[model samples]
Target: MNIKKKSALVLSAATVMLGLYTGAAAQQIEKPLKKNTATTFAIVVDQETYNKAKQEINAYKSALEKQGLGTYIVSHQWTKPEEIKVVLQKLYSDKNRLEGAVLIGDIPIPMVMDAQRLTSAYKFDQARFGFRAAVPSDRFYDDFNLKLNFIKQDSLKAGNFYYSLAPESAPEIHPDIYTARIKAPAIKGKDKYELIRTYLSKVVAEKEQQNRLNHLMVYSGMGYASESQTAWASEQVALREQLPQLFRAGSSAKFVNSRMQGDLKQRLLTEVQREDLDLAIFHQHGESDVQVISGYPNVSFPQPSIENVRRYLRNKIQAANRKKQDVAETKKRFQATLGVPMAWMDDALTDSVVLADSLFEANGNIMMEDVDKIRSNVRMLILDNCYNGSFHKDDYMSGHYVFGSGKTIVAMANSINVLQDVWTTELIGLLQHGVRAGNWFKEQAYLETHLIGDPTFAFTAEGNTDYNELIVNKDGSDPVWKQLLKTGDADLQALALTKIFYAQGAASSSLLKDVYYSAADASTRMQAWKLLSTLNNADFKAVLKDALTDPYEYLRRRSANMAGDFGTDDLVPALVASGIEDWASKRVAYNSGNSMSFMNADLVIAQLQEYLKKPEFAGNTDIQRLIKRQEGTREKVLKEGKVMEDKKAVAKERAFDVNMLRTYTYHELVPQAIAIAADAAEDHKLRLAAVEALGWFPYSYQKDKIVALCDQLIADKNSTAQLREEAMRTKTYLLHFSAEKYQTVAKK
Candidate 1:
């Protein structure tokens, strides 16, 4: 173990002082507690397991009771997850007796199956490109209050959490109910009950132990996000300013993008595997199988983008390409052109991303598979990413823990978008004041409900038929109502307006116009636009034109989407300006169009193309709206970020998906897309997406040019293998123009 620094421990204000209770048997505490009971818990067990492990179960009760908890043990057949929720809710409704609950034995986990039409990663080559859904929820069990975010049309979301210690693997029950929080000792050839005991024992000791370690590893992976400028990176200066009050000065090890040694991920892993560090915080994109940290520097540029040799060669002749039109970062911010690197995502699985031989197993790459080998005394680990917490014991035992550790994993319980800064900062404050790791997310889930009056992590415009019922008709005394009627706080006022619209379902043009024109919140302005669309066509058009100068990106993006929907061709220039406005912010549409949440960005990007068709047809309604009904402007905007964020965005990282898969045609916007496809400075994900759009470019106006573009890509020796392969696939599948079909024309 390596020691970084030394410090005196400061007692937390919220820390509980434990009284010694020697040699006491466990006793169950029933309802109607004494007025001054210190703490309470519910221990839920599978009825079958109680018969075999009644004594062992009693030990669990004793362990918790020794820590000053009034423990209650209950057995249930565990029929439906809803039944479990009702039981817990009924217990918690009595605030005096319930603070948290533990599920012991083979409790079945509930799942949220998110089936959306968005392009999902093709499982294999033979799979057709089509819309799909997944179980994206990670924290389904935490919200006993019950709001699963899986309701968008074509989207089936299940946010129910049930951690079970069954003999069968989780996949056998459901493909998505993975909890990467624990290292199942079944892999170590130990009994599962013994592992649970170990976990409970460790937690109890850590919370009660007077000794404290101050060292922390603060890690931020500034890897290849959509674009370099939009790295899932937040400034460290904010952390520097806020941390010392909670932790000792100079007791932290920060691994950020700027200050890195040999390999960023390797360095961080080396320290974490050690038995010394107490806590590690990773702030970046991650997955169930890997953490998207700084990759091989040789393979990835240290800056926003790498110099594209091909762009310089082609720039002289291409006058109307998307590159020429793009004004986001290249010409506007960096004053240079850069492109995605040649090293593919597959590199992470090969020597392309090699690790120190001793540190990594024979097959491992950047992803460390050493949670089961943890010699560390770490108490907690926080990974803020989708599906990162989808860890299972079998994986750890088989040496496949993606980001797993022996410590309690603090992560998003499901596949929902959580504001990292807000929740993380709050958690740190609680920990500093002595809240246990096991209880952090429970506190967070409940707090989220109180703050926004909802238990779901994300809300979308797609298939939530229950939004009106959920948002509307709240108690008149709720805080949002109070703010709406009494105060002028912009955020609260905006929230109030959205709730009112949902409850009433209609608004006169004058009332909508007032909020549209003068509501202080940008979100409020955006919400006003949706309701205004219900008005006369002329009124809607006028509002969009006026929105051209709206102060925030949210309103402006919504205006652009409305303009597209109405087919206002004259506003092309305004749409372009908005599409590229503050492009690096990494919103759902990201540097394209900011249609409320992810829908309009998706709509407007293609809309920018489709509406330009023929230069005469009023805005065509052909482009489908994926999320039609949203909770509010914030739900429309922030929630879409959750939807559009790709699992592995860059080329070859995720399965190939072209938004044009459904349309398979190019509108007049091909030139703009061509400009993007031809540009070297664009993000690889965007460029690849553009290339796919170009694959079917000949479907309409570019029909005559398809053969030439395909041939050009196929013959280019310098093009990425990925691009060339995709071009070949397009020719093989979509165009039906194989070598045999073009052999005679190829000679020309």
Candidate 2:
């Protein structure tokens, strides 16, 4: 059939199948409809797999529509695990009308998992289907009540397909293969693709010899074989037949094969000599040390034996040398001979030992046997598989087993479960397309930008990627990950401001401020202030002002917290003049009781005095009690000069300097005692004695200052904010009293 005719037939068949499937599905549903709306069935896949999966899904949707069941297909390109959540949330929120979802490949698995969580939170009943590699159903099954299904594709099916199609006269296929064996039930679509490719290769080769056919075209070929030499051969023949004059008559015909597996070294060598093949393509599981090839039953070639791998490597190296070339050069030459660039497509292999070890150590379990191997061979590994990145520190390493200093990069999914294979393929395809289009590194950055929409989603380095010259600028500034890691004092602090910003319900303003206070980096401190401006609280005003003048310009521009719910009384005039108007101005008001806990006594006294001047406070019984208690405590402290014996008389006397007590009222005596407690004397005994004497004052008035001073001493700072605030309060009180006296004299 012509290409156009074939496409039409495929589309028609797909539409028919979708209709039938939808009709059958509608008949099976007995539940009452909550609403009549078209439901979206979204699938996340790699770009290459997208066209195929989308075609199938669209067909399914069309079929369903025919049966009067609403269905729409939402497709997303998967580059990162978090992209799953992002796309799902958008679909769920916008489409609130989805009844069921079908996830294909790795990116969709995490999204579906999160969707299950969201459904439980929202109390919605939704069915989910997962298609790709198998997942551990136990984690979400009970909570989500999920009905799960998987496509199991392994090495065994790949091996059997290769063996069945091999020339009968070739070496006898091994029946008891140990490493390349894969357990059935094999992946449905994959098996069909393998069978079709094997059949086409034989047919095309025979026809070319007898009839001297210029070209051949093959259709319905999928999976690994679609990228192989057989497909390439068919394409070359078809092209030659169509464009006779465009090509030189004597030009050598080239064949390009993709997705080749099982003993690649041997297979490529054999084809290069016997079939005069120029390029070989293989895709399967791969790691730093070995590549997995399919074998009989459940076995795979190139198992994790170092000696066996070394021997294979040695042979290949020797073969290349004898051919007077390097391996990469030889591979390139082979491709050139075949007239097509060899393309090997497969997901990056994650080291099982690394994953298991990482998980075991994260949970505080120790597996000592695999530590050495993991450190040595598993560098620059990408866990394109699902759930591989979920392992924490204890899961793989105990404190005793230190990771080696090696050039390795390990990227994996943070969530638990294997991601669908399609996501990996799509990411690789995007990367390849981008590189071929002359924007290699920018593509990775673009992927990251799309995945982590906010500054909070960090792209950090592990192993060699951490040390890449590309990561560090010429000035030797720390990389992004290093900067992020050092932003907060602890993991919880880091989460509150950084990672938590991407996920909702993960942080609060007060918690974020605490993180800011502890943060050493000026940039991070500014970030905290920016986050605080979004909240309706007065506590952040002073801190925000401090950050605006911070040495870092990045901090100054971003940390403008002038507005947003801050109390007018608390906001300094200097802060108001800074021209920061991006936030709200309605501050969270606090009463005396609330202020007492968080504020120092000086601040509390100042506020109380202001309240007492008001008609409401003047008539209140609680205000009267608070005033009487303050008076009684002050009188008692004055009468009994040194209440505690711990303080030496001379030290106590020196601490209570009369000049410090500007207020004559008994309440003013408390500040004198507080000042004494914080005095740093030469003798430790005298310091303790002075501290004891200060204890005689009302604890409420003196407690905050003493604690603040102690904290300052520990931090090795000159004084605490509490001390400065108290001094300012004392200065204000003296000025107010002097003005009142002057006014009285003037009136007389």
Candidate 3:
């Protein structure tokens, strides 16, 4: 059948299935009895799965209702993502203020495009890759503030639709309601409907018991931050502040590192399988099918036993053969290195024992095939990696963890590549306050990040009040929030300050700054810094200067990382001081080095000279090396700028350089981008890339220059249609972002 005919047939089948399920579901689907004061939650499902698991779905609703949530099972044959978004928007505004929703069982997926800024670290040429470049996100449904322009549905994938976050929409993501996906993976030899039924039943059973926010396990794999020990250690310290109770005398908070064990794969499996383990965090690199936990096993270096040498030779020979290399040459090269005989090499190549040993040793990573055998009892799993939560794929890691034969109910992950610099554990302390996992995920709202499981899943409360209840009710007054700020719980105090910030905007700037200094808890201090930075007033510059020396290492690291965007000479002194003093901390030193490249180069150089003159740095041998590194990074930036404008360079490589400028916005590149965008003789694709890159400099001091260039291209009648279109987009983005920023200033 042709593509048109196939789509028509799918539509017809969807319509029929909808009619049949709606007729049957009138009895099983529970409509909300009370919509007042945001007490309702939604379970949205596709019709076919609802028909197959009606009893299981109803029991899941009962489980939520027992927990005081007025549950609604909205079963439909979802063809377009917009249809679901409309339903969610209506629910959000109606008397039944929706707190959260879970899209289950083959619901339509929205692939968001042209809004890379909303993501933590996702940027691609949408025109080149088309639908594939777009992110599979449910933010299209939950974030009502974002105005999206529906582009079209995927011609091949039935339920995949493309949308763009309109430039006129909200500049930042503040999701109106939390959302999760409970979709089962489309694995062969397994019935997805049966898996959904089993998973729903497990969720019901799991929710029946009181699950507490204790027994945490955190792991770090190789290749993240180049395995930076400082970043890894700081996370544990931050987690202690986030989950204070976990660090208490008898409670459990285990930290696992890949290098700590020779066979970490089995050790991770054993730890995850522990019944008492409440949460597991996998901080590593990943793909749709596998979690890359580590590289080679830790064996003795420089010298090794004969058996280990033989094992390494066997694995290398097998790899060479698989890659169509000459196995004889590979074996001979290993022989020369080890002085082994040719007969021994032949045996290593042909022996089944060698192959078996190679297979046994190659257990560093976890693949989709490894998921089915283990019953993971960890209540929640956080995959802090890339593409591990791609629910649209047939065999995704997060979906298998939730719906496979496991007690793992919820998993948080990203659908695309995410930045390592993101604060993954932000607002995590709310989990101890009885806030749902979905709510915690919602607050750290990135376009690509998602929760893959029940949205209503929550750990038992440690304190007297369920903070989720107060947040849902929307009855928080200034007086109530101020009272909470005085409470003993630091996370609660942070949440209260967030509420006040949202309501009062920059009006609360003074209070936030006060809290930043006076608050004893690191969590509260970090929260104060976050809100203050978002305001970006004069106070932000003052606080940022002080934060470089803040007792909280993570806070200091973040401050140094962001100081480049402000691009003022005032911050140069602090940035230099931190870079010199914090050189022992790999991530802090690394970020500070990068931040210097975007600041005033002369100011940075002057600051470095002053630092070298100090008596404390008289004997420091690394100072000159650090100065050269700063100069080298600036030179690298200059070279990359030239690459963006070089017509002789490969188009894809030049476009990549353009995208990187957006990630690390350097003011020096702004004029080059404007030049490329203005020259009509330039390649159309490159010009458009230039236009888009200019939008990311909203935080740069040279933003007005960008705005002027965008306006010029927008008005020129001789401009190409594509150029004009992109210019309009960039202009809208700059204006909307600036308006939002100054709105907070206006409130102050």
lDDT of 3 by residue, 1-748 (tens): 8999996674344332212222334312346543343467888888788889988988898788778788777777666776677767766776767889998888888888888878887877676787778998888888888888899988888788888777567767778889999888876688988988999999999997887888999988877765767777877877887898898876799987776756788888888888888889998888998888776555676444555666667778778977999998887787788787666556655668765766665587888777777888899999999999988777799887888777898999898889877777877889987898877787777998999988788899986776776776544344778898888777888888887887767677898999998998877888999888776677777888999888777788889887887777778888988888887677778778878888877778778878788998875667777678768877877888788678788878787877677777887878888888888888888888889989887657877888888889878998887777777777776665432554543210
Best by lDDT: 3
Instruction: Estimate the overall C-alpha local distance difference test score of candidate 1.
Output: 0.40
lDDT of 2 by residue, 1-748 (tens): 7999997775444331111122223111111122244333232334333344444434444543443334433334443333333333444444333322333322222212112111101111111122221221211211121222222223432211000111111111111100000001112233322322232232222222312212211111112222234323433433333223224664233332323333333432233232221111223222222222332222244454433333333344346756777666655654466453333201101256335433432322112333323332111122222222222111222111112222111222222332111112111211211111011111121100111000000112112222111211111122343354443223212322532332221234555567577765443454465445434244455566565455443343333322211213343232332322211111111112222222233443455555667765566555455445445544554544443222455644443333212112123344545545456543444333333332222212333464454444435455444333333323222222221222222100
Q: Using TM-score, give the best candidate's number.
A: 3
Local lDDT at 148 for model 2: 22
Error of 1 at 392 (Å): 6.8
When 2 and 3 are scored with lDDT, the better candidate is: 3
Q: lDDT ranking from best to worst?
A: 3, 1, 2
Off by over 4 Å in 1: 1-40, 47-70, 76-83, 95-99, 114-186, 210-216, 222-224, 227-253, 273-279, 283-294, 299-368, 391-590, 593-748
Q: Give TM-scores for every candidate, taking all chains together and pairing residue i with residue i.
A: 0.45, 0.20, 0.88
lDDT by residue (tens digit), candidate 1, 1-748: 2232221111122122222222352212233222333445566666665555666556656655664455566555554454444555555555443555655555544434311111112111212332222332323444432234322332232223423211111111111111123223234455655555555454444444443435566665543223233322332322332333324564654545523545565566676665545556665655544565653233345342232232322332132233465433322222333333333211222332233322322222234344455543444555543334443223321122312334432233323223332234332322432333333343233111111000111111222223222222243234555355344433234445544543343333455677778765454465566555543244556777778556654444345544443333455546554544434444313323433232333444544455445455344332222122212433433432332244334543322333532232224344445555555665665655656555543223343354456567678787786666555544433332122232222110
